[model samples]
Target chain A: MIITSKKAIMFVLSKIEGAVLMAKRGMLIVLSGPSGVGKGTVRKALFEDPEVDFNYSISMTTRNPREGEKNGVDYYFVSKEQFEENIKNGEMLEYAKYVDNYYGTPLNYVNEQLNAGHDVFLEVEVNGALQVRANCPDGVFIFLTPPDIKELRSRLVGRGTDDLEVINKRIQKASKEIRMMQNYDYAIVNDKIKNAVEQIKDIVKSERLKVNRVMPDYLDSLGDEI
Target chain B: MIITSKKAIMFVLSKIEGAVLMAKRGMLIVLSGPSGVGKGTVRKALFEDPEVDFNYSISMTTRNPREGEKNGVDYYFVSKEQFEENIKNGEMLEYAKYVDNYYGTPLNYVNEQLNAGHDVFLEVEVNGALQVRANCPDGVFIFLTPPDIKELRSRLVGRGTDDLEVINKRIQKASKEIRMMQNYDYAIVNDKIKNAVEQIKDIVKSERLKVNRVMPDYLDSLGDEI
Candidate 1:
């Protein structure tokens, strides 16, 4: 009887420990969309909401910091050489170069925060988001889309450029980006920022309740317990 | 210029039509769990919430209508021969015999409601749920679970049954049902009915936003528009 009780206690303890470990592993959420589809605005609004519980992944950049930008807060301002070195060593999760300056998500910081059970949120351009997807295929990828194709085209045309050819080119680019929505798990139309935020919050809540994510730990813990 | 304008109009019309069609196809959601895990209570609470938009699927049963049980509202009470005939004709989505009484979900009603864009909700036993899964694999399957195995055991014991053997049998059966949660898409612990309802509502919201379900119509509509 004592032996059986000891075995039962051990099983319960292991189950509790497994639950703890599972709870401590946080999710990674990547939000990306077409250039003029307001990904940045939605992300900012989401972060400003006190109900949103996520740690924004501060990116590392080789570009000169703008006025009032703080190191390690706004971004981890790094030398071009240091950024290149990190890329060479694969310490960057995803990186892109624009105007001779490199900007990238650091792998180490994301891993650290995830291990500490803090959901890490990344808002990136479509290309950068693709790169992140290649590295972390399991991350929740959300693609934000405009209300409609006409809306997207109108936004491109209204971008303070009366050049017809330039507007056409921007529209084509937006179309390509919209096509990339197929690569994402969920798509939320950015009709209103508040609506988008609420949908995203619900998505996170639903993902957390998914059986695939929550059951493996239980199965492992219940091994031979029954 | 005339041809281009005509083509654009057709494309836009087709896209609008596709969106309308997509919006009209409703989702099928199944809620199931162990026999005594309070699936009925949670489902009741969910339906009582004014925010839930799903239509409760009334089941058909081959049993005498108890006090105040209406024919169509409470259950589609039918003769055993009729129920068996429906099962033989494959008109039943799922059916089971309990206490020598036949109970089943009617496929025609569910399909008609879904075609009309009414999200249909089903609360069934695990076996019946598996049958539904076989017929409608795309349905959202939510498994209700106890907060913990210990809690499950206590619930079984507290059922006013002093027979140890019966209690053990109940526990073992519950374990098997819980293990079957692997076949489900989501698991919401029935710690509190309110909490479960919220989680379920969030899950439906997220499922509605899934790219797999929403983008197919967009892609089909945009076939040559881009």
Candidate 2:
């Protein structure tokens, strides 16, 4: 007996979505870690595992694509002017100025997957991840840590690149990030790749069953809305 | 070196306990639902599943021994005077009077088990469960609900004793409790017993890995406190 506009209907639907178990949006899982902490390795293992259903957010970077790097897939290779325009227009979720280039997560693709009930993963810096938390408070922020700084240092050196100065700088940044780990929702110790991935998987699965995700339709359908 | 009293050391230890995961106190899991919600059946199944490590709390009551009920195992049968004394002494964590008999949970036993690293389960009324929450804020509160109210009604009637009046009273109480499901940390649909048990187990396992539970020793040992 109620008539409403499409927008009003969508508004009501979202409210119902909050209470009901019907098709809900996918979770936003943000992953942040120190340099040389194996974020890339953990992410690769996660992608290879068929059990987890998630899409990695392809970030927009102003830097030129290195050899073998594909545009739009590996990175959303963008012009410095275009990246700045997106920032000026309030499109970038979070952006940072690196050594020379700018890197940021675009708003659209992440939200697109989330709207389709697909979980999205973003490997972000702590500052950018905190910004995403402000923009999307419901997102889960997981801080991935190495077994130890020695391992992180060795891994950085193990890459067989980056001189002593760069390695020390990376180590310093890692220490600062590690101190802020308390602000994150979950911390994963990356001593064992399988264990870390398993912990993250369990966290996601358990999060889906939180009371906030209850479907009001199911409850209302349970014999006269009791 | 700074010298401190045993009391000071205890206080410091408790403070460290909050920050580090040295020897964690076992989790306190509170389970509650309506009369026909199959709480007992589900609990039995969970206990039988050797994968879970938990012990059921023994509640104190003023009622006399009913047939084969053991003194300590079934319920700690106490007189009205003794029960009143414990309540006055603040020993009862939570209690309620039903049919002119007092039923309560003693604080010491549950804490003892938690300190010893054994999870404890307490099945109580919604009111009592909330009281337990106030006392043990860190405890995980799980609300067990039936698939639907009609099933609950049928199950109550299936007991073959409760007349129409009592069944209606119980149903009404359950409806009120269901509306308060928002306060709980988790709401599990009791369609399949195994599935319910599995979900609870997963929640406990995930909780242990929370960022707040990081062991200081592990972090300190991680190659120069980074």
Candidate 3:
């Protein structure tokens, strides 16, 4: 019996040591939502919350940015050649082309922020979120939607930027996106921006307490004691 | 152009109405963790805090009541015949036999608490938690573990109830439980009980603001005429 107790204690000590090592590693949070679901509004509100230190990720784009858009701030505008080079080098987490312009997430800024122990938020399309998940298996993925399909259509049309034809196309695209909601770790319906922001904020704040993210040492210590 | 704007307004209005309906539903939250990870300690702390109005669920069992165990206080002790009847009637969420005695969750009390707009916590085994999840898919699940396996084993052994053999058995069971941590909605490593309690409190506070849980009529008015 004494020997067994000693063995148990030794086993516990080794596990605790491993957990302490893992505590230093960072965790990633990914937010994805359908278009025109006020994801931007929610993000803005979240960033404004003083309690959270969030690192905003600027995307790399080959397209010409609009007026008052800075190279690094608005987007890391690069030449098509540079963009293609980064893609070949696997420096981008995910990339897509739109109207002959390429946009992608550059891995550097995100990694830097995560290493600094600050949570990073990525506002991306559904496809981009999925790609991030594939690359970073540990990332927390949240999918946002309007309360219902009817409301989603109205949000898209209410923007007044799209013509009827464009609006219809968006509605169809949203239908497809809504079906993918189950793939997310959590779903936040954009029925109320304030409420949705609170939900996302809660998810972010709660995620920090995850054993893998903040307490590997804690878990390891839960075993036998040396 | 005017027609396009009008259509958009109508769409937004309807979306808000739908959100209001979904908000009327009560939300469920499930709290689970390994034994001796201080889940009970954290829960008591949360209850003491004014912000948490959570109802604690007392399970029903067929085991004879021990001294000082009052009906509906510690548990609702029922005869084996009554428990079997409950099982036949689908009145229990989950049931299992331990040491030849049956323990199960009664659905009535849980539903009553939930319908009264209170978040009910069923401190049950993983099997029971799973059954609750199956019954209520929208319920949020939280799993707790110790900061390290060593700490957990220490806590278990420190209780002084079990000898080396019993402690070893618990340790083996815990290893299996750790593997199932991924099935949880959130994993909380209990290093400091106060800190862990705060984290869980934050989650409950934030989850209350979910779009589906909070009414959204105000949002529809954002785009409507005064």
Candidate 4:
């Protein structure tokens, strides 16, 4: 009877040790880039990976849903009245209007996801990304660019849908975006999808090793013993 | 005769290829830290592997050399007049006066070693590191730190060389330096010598892979083909 009770105690201690080892909080990664720079492709690759315990925060908007879009899954799809109310009530972190429609990020969902110990990624335009930084200064920012101006123009044209004038306008806009690249913490040149994704993964993995963010509190809680 | 001539051409091509593959450039890595952070131990371990091509850049001083010190190798041992003249002529990148003596980094030797493709390291105080940053903005800056305040004071007292009052003074000074930690580009906590050295090595290797610095101008020189 005594031997069995000792074995049960040992088993409980082992389980407790394992749980302690696994306790680690998640991070917030904010990815920003000019349009057509392949942020979506890289993000898609990350989403497909199982080892990463992270999720992209689906942004909420007041705009009408497009075909095949499901409410709360694709987006919250709130009415303009509700959205404006949330904005006034300080529920929206940042919001902007485009094409006569309102789009904004609901803060409650992001905070809930972060609290649940899952890293959240926000994929937004440069303006929205700047707003996120202003609100959450600790967020990591990554900027992406193409190999060169010619390649960027070629990629835009190769899409085969945009007219020549639209492509030219996009190219001009991209040039202006490139000028602001220096303000970013890190600039990734997306010459190849696979390599670019790998580089970004390395950055995120290495950032997790940063000393300041890694919890010294846990060590302190270990008390006078290891 | 024709066979011999072909063999000679092959040999020349192989030699040129080897030279291209072996081409390496030196870097200046400045390591700064708060007092009692164990940077010295990590630096010693780094030099243990001679193939790293790492050389510590010794600062020249106007102070009298200690017994058995070599003139150029240990320090430049410049006269006070020469040191002040170098400062006037912008030869000294950064300098400080202490105890009626002067210490400064000589610009010529550092650049000469860098041009010869050897990576130089400056183990300096935070103030000196900041000066280096201002003068040579491209050089890498690494700040070493302790795992926590408790560990830092423990290490300081564990040395057994300083009195209690002196240790307390150092602890106060260290906290001040730790507050300036964010000024550095990278900070590695010196928890253990081997771990810290590995972290530093990772940082150096990754910094070397920066795309903009490594992107050869030969691509542009190759004209529109790129």
Ranking of predictions according to lDDT: 1, 2, 3, 4
Q: Estimate, for each residue in A125-215, the C-alpha lDDT of model 3 and write its tens digit.
A: 8888889999888887888865554655566665767676675565556556666665676777777777777777778787676545644
Q: Candidate 4, A205: how far from true, in Å?
A: 6.3
Candidate 4: clashing pairs of residues: none
Every model's TM-score: 0.87, 0.74, 0.66, 0.59
- For TM-score, the strongest prediction is 1
Candidate 4 per-residue lDDT over residues A58-123, each given as its tens digit:
888878889999997768898888988998999976778888778778888788877776778877
Ranked candidates, highest DockQ first: 1, 2, 3, 4
Lowest-scoring 10 consecutive residues by lDDT in candidate 3 chain A?
A: A217-226
Residues B1-226, model 3: lDDT tens digits: 7686666656656655654555344567777776666766777676777876778778899999999989998799999999999999999977888888889889888787777666787666777778888889888788876444566666776676777777777777766667556657677767777777778887777666444444233233232322
lDDT per residue for candidate 1 within A18-125, as digits (tens), equals 665665578899998877889878988998899998899988998988999999987999999999999999899999998899988999989999888888999888
The predicted structure with the larger TM-score, 1 or 4, is: 1
Q: Where does model 4 sit among the CAPRI classes?
A: incorrect
Better of 2 and 4 by TM-score: 2
* Residue A177, candidate 3: alpha-carbon lDDT: 61
Higher-TM-score candidate of 2 and 3: 2
DockQ, Cα level, model 3: 0.26
Show how many residue pairs clash in every candidate, following the order shown. Answer: 0, 4, 23, 0
